[model samples]
Every structure is written in structure tokens, then in C-alpha cells.
Target: MLYDYPEYYETAFSFRNIEEESRFLTKCINRFSKIDVKNVFEIACGNAPHAGLLQEMGYSYHGLDINRNMLDYAAYLWKDLPNKVNLHEASMVDFKYPIKQDFAYVMLGSLYLNDFDEIVSHFNSMSNLLNSGGLYFLDWCIQFGDPLAHNNNNRFVIEKDGIEVESEFNIKLLDQEQQMYEEVWTIKINDRGRRKQFNMVERNKAILPDQFLRFIKERDDFEFIGWWKDWNLDNPIEDENNVTRPIALIRKR
Candidate 1:
């Protein structure tokens, strides 16, 4: 099940800098495309913090996710926004929108589909939804070696208002042949001394930059722009081992 614990999902990654992230995305759209980016689409927008900020910036935001729980949470998060914000419960591989978008993005490792066919299908669907010369951006973490062996486990404790959240993350390589891994997140929440705990296990594939570039080149609907090591557009991806999350920017042909 995807995003089984929406509460834990909200708590685990609660500290992300939404303003900076949205600004980065906006900068990318401004620099790469000639169209005025008023409508934006996001694939697997969990909680949609970025979309909420983007909507506040006067863009119409549309977010799609297969998890209804996540979409409901995203709706609640964006309830106070003034601009148009729409949340849809749909899979990225086969979703069809009524209108074409000027820009689209898939943040985090949400672009990791089940297999090569699913990846291709997602790209095709996304390309079909974008106008000519539009932009599509995606980012994901690349695992070079065993994450557990490298002591990559994380523990986060966040306290806000009257609630306290403690989250522990454990990652393990599940299959070597398929280049797959699983991340188990255990979250403990204390709200006014009332304690609750839950666990969410996420399975993802480690797709290298070369593999993604190859896929983009194979498709005629998109043209490869460039890639960044992390979030900084100035820093190109030189060594995959040095960077945890790499971002790819492409344009629809």
C-alpha cells in the first residue's frame, strides 16, 4: 500500500523548507521555458507543500497522487490558499488531465516506478499533458551502496504547537538484481501527552543518472536539458557517489 500512514508521512518530512524549494522550482521554470508558467502539475504530490506555496505565488496548481489519504491531507493543507489548487487521486503512469500544463514536476523519489515499462509510461503520460516546449522536472535520491552499511539511518524529533513527533528511518537493500530497496519509517507522536505510533514501509528503485538520461534520449517527445547534483542548478552532477539526490530537467519537444 502506498502512503498507508499519511500522518506519519506528514510528520517524518515536516521540516522541509517549502519556500526555498518552491523558489528553486520557479527559477527553473523561468530560466528554461519561454511560456508564462501559470499552470503547474505535480506527480505524487504528497501533502503538496510545494503546490500550496506555488498556488500562493499566483499559479494554478494541480497535484496527482494514487493515495487518497495523501490527497485529502493535501486538500486540507491548501484550504486557505487563494489561488486555484486541485488535488486528484490518480496514478502517474496513466493519468490524463483535461488541460495541458506549462510546467510539471515530480519531487523526491516519487518518479521511481515499478519497472522500466512503468517509467516509460509515466514519461509518455506527462509529455502528453504538457504544451509544446514546456518543461518537466524530477528529482530522486540515488543509492550507490548499501544505505544501512553507510550508517544512513535517520532519527528526527520535531515539536510544534502542543504536539511532538519522533521519527526513526531505517533503510535496507531488498534486491540487488533489480536495484531495489525498502525504507521503514517508525513514527511516534505525542499530542498533549497522548501517545500514538505507526510504521510505513516504502519501496523504491535506485535509478542512476545514466539510466534516466538513456530513457530520455530514447523518447522523441522530450529533449534533455541538464541535471544538477543536488538542488543547486550551478552544480552539475559530476560524481553520483558524492550526491544523495540528483535533479533532472527536461523539455517537452
Candidate 2:
């Protein structure tokens, strides 16, 4: 599972709304955290669109990811902000920081610990990296209608600097019992007369909301600070109609 194709990943996903998301994060920090937040940490940060916003908000940003290619891409993208941005190649479950951070977050449901023990270990590691009043935030995707209904094909086209990139996604639910799904993406890049094609497969497990909440509660290091449906802080988690993803906020106890 090499994540070297950062250009394809960034083209396939939309991170253009980072400013709005950063504003919401600031609001959450103000509402939930009791201490002044100066430093921030991110786990499994791929290409780090949010870290740019954190830097603009005057926070020293440190990001860790298991993929070396992604870290390299992040370093390239954030090269101008060297003083404020730092990226490390590390795993989510076994990474350490010299100084304690005031806030930590993982977005886009990237907390991919499969088992309970792995979840506990990741949470404990995060708790150890945070100060007493620090906050840890993450989001989980919940199936509202049917878990099997997500099997479909989608296409996207992105144009930049007179070059067009076309991406086709073939998605399927591989195993319901294991909460596993697979996506095969076929990408075509057309630059003038030159054309290139690449295919990649991505597999991931869908972690349920209740299971994650239970895991956090079982660990005494963090206090559950409630969850919101989607990006709206005013909306509660019970409102499933508007929430495709549930965001959980926890404070280090």
C-alpha cells in the first residue's frame, strides 16, 4: 500500500473548504478547551490541508503519517512555512512527541485502528502527547440508510494548468461482517498530446460510532465531550437525517 500518488489523491478528494473547516475547529477549541492552544498535532495526516489553516491561525503544526511519500508531498506543499510546519514519518499507534500539545485531531475518518486493543493503544498514545486540558477530535462515517447501498461507480474530472485529469471510481462492499470495503480508481491524465493511465485499489474498514464511543469511554485517559452530526456544532448526533459523518470531541483527563 504505497501512498506515493499524492497528486491523484488530492485530485480525487476535495480539500478546498479547508478555511471553513479550520474556522469550525477554532470554534470547537474555544468551546471545549479550557487552556490556551498554541501547538497542534495531527495523526495520519495525509497531505495536510488542515495544517495550512492551523498555521495561518498562529499554531505550530506537527503532523505524523505512516506513509513516507505522503510526508514528502506534505513537506513540498508546506515548504514556504518551514518555521511553522513540521512533518514526521510515524505510525498513529506508536508515535511520540518531545513536547505536549494543546490540541490534536484526525479528520476524514482516518483513525483506522481495526481492533479494540489497537484503539486503546492509539488513544493512550494521544493522551500521553497532550497536556492536561488538551483536546482530541476525530470523525466517523455512519451509514444512515443501508450499509450495502454504497456500491456504485463515480467519475470526476479536474483541470489544472491546461491539463485535464479524469478519475473513475469503482466501489464495492467486500465484507459486511468485517466492515470492509474496496475501491478501485482508474485515473487518466491528458497533457497536450501525452496521455497516462494509472489504477489503484484502496481498502478500508468502517468503524461504527457506538463502537468508537465505547472504546473511548473504556479508556480513562479521555473524557467524552459529546459529538455533533456533520460540521454543525449546534446539531446533535441523534439527528441522523443531516449527518453522514459524526464528529467526536474528547478532552484529556
Candidate 3:
């Protein structure tokens, strides 16, 4: 099963700043109007913390995650706002519901996957999930444009409640044509010399700003708004600060 390790799932909690993320999304949302974005949907909404903010803002928001355990935890944490906030165990690729929404969000590069065709299908699906004048905001990773770089592998180890868990990540380039990378996630738990292993592999396309713009531009269902290259909402596309992770917005046209 995917995301079976409780420890790794817990580790992911620290990798993001939920409050800052919420603020960033809110800034984007404020671009349109103050009218209640009455209905909101978030795909790959791990732990669903962002939905909490949306709920506080008086929006009816739904959260969806591919991991069952993550969704279960979200349900427990957000039990008080059950009506306003609902978390589902589903992937962004195929999740569907009856009601369309005023806004939809997919954060933290979670949309990256093995297939470009599947990714396009998902973008289209998400566009369909929004209302005519609705918005879909996405924050994703972009290729480091530096001329000097190489395949990188990294590891993080932490101790919580006396349990030592180690997580290893390997990012490998898949040649030049596709500009894709295969990510290998491995987590190991060790207690008094006894170790257990859990692993997951996913292939994702590494995006660049130009390519990203072209892809979104070619889609007929949506109109490309712009991108935030380094968190500057105004003129974010050209503001490169050594690295570029873009937050792009689109309106269902």
C-alpha cells in the first residue's frame, strides 16, 4: 500500500509550513473578490490543515488525499467542522463529485506523477470541477535553471516518542528529452538493532516556467492567469532567487 508508514506520514507534517501556505493561498484568493467563495475543493489535501483556514474564512471546503491514514487523521482533527469540511480518501487523478465549486486548490507539487497524459487529464478534470468564473490555484516545483547541478540523494532522521525513524530520498534525472525524474522514498524504523523498511517509487515530470506556461496555455477549458516564481504575486514569473517554485493560477473560461 502507498504511504503505509505512519512515521513517514508524520514526517511530512514538518516539511511544510501550514500557516504560511494558508496565507499564500489566501493572498491568491483575495485577487478575485470578497464574496464568499462558498464552495472550495482541495486535491491531495494531506492532513487537511489548509481546509481548516478555509472553514474559518466561512467557506465550505472539501479535502481529498490519496492516503487513507492521512484522511482518517484529517477526519479526526476536523470532526468539529464536519459539515463545512469533508476529507476523502481519493487521488487527484480520478476523484469526482456532483457539485462544482467556486475555487479549487492543489498545493505543494503533489500533482507530479509518472504520466504527462494523466496529468493533463487531471488538470482538465479539475477545470471541470470549477464554476465558469471560478479559479484553480496550483503551487508546484520547477526545474532549477542553474547550469551546474547533478542527481541528488538526501536523508532525514528524527526521533519522536523514543522511536527512531529514518527517511531517504533519491532524485534521478531521466535524460534530456522528457525532463523527468524518478523519486524513490524509503523509510526505515529501527529499535535496538531491529529494522523495518517501507518504500515507494514515483516518476514525475520536472517543470520549467516556459514549458509550464505553454502547457496551460494550450488547454481550452482554462485561461492562464500567471505564475509566482519566488512568491512575489506581482511579476513573479521573472523574479528568480537562485531557485524557482511557481504558484500558478487559472480561471475556468
Q: How much does candidate 1 score in TM-score?
A: 0.89
lDDT of each: 0.78, 0.76, 0.70
Backbone-clash count (model 2): 0
Q: Estimate each model's TM-score.
A: 0.89, 0.85, 0.82
Question: Can you write out model 2's per-residue Cα lDDT over 1-253, one digit (the tens) per residue?
Answer: 3257776567556535788878888889999997899998888888987887788888889898989889888988988874757787887866677878999988776776654566667777898899988898886544344434434436778876556778776767888887777767688877666877888776666666666677677878888898887588898777453345577888998
Lowest lDDT 10-residue stretch of candidate 1: 141-150
Residue-level error in angstroms, candidate 1, position 36: 2.2
Off by over 4 Å in 3: 32-36, 82-84, 144-153, 157-165, 189-196, 239-244
User: Between 1 and 3, whose lDDT is larger?
Assistant: 1
Winner by lDDT: 1
lDDT of 3 by residue, 42-157 (tens): 88877777777777776787877888887877777778874646767766776576788888887767775556777777877787778887888777655546312323436778
Alpha carbon lDDT at 216, candidate 2 = 70
Off by over 4 Å in 1: 1-8, 141-153
Q: On a 0 to 100 scale, what is the lDDT of residue 47 in model 2? A: 91
**Candidate 2 vs candidate 3, lDDT winner:** 2
Show model 2 residue runs off by greater than 4 Å.
Answer: 141-147, 168-171, 191-193, 239-242
Candidate 2 yields a Cα-based lDDT of: 0.76
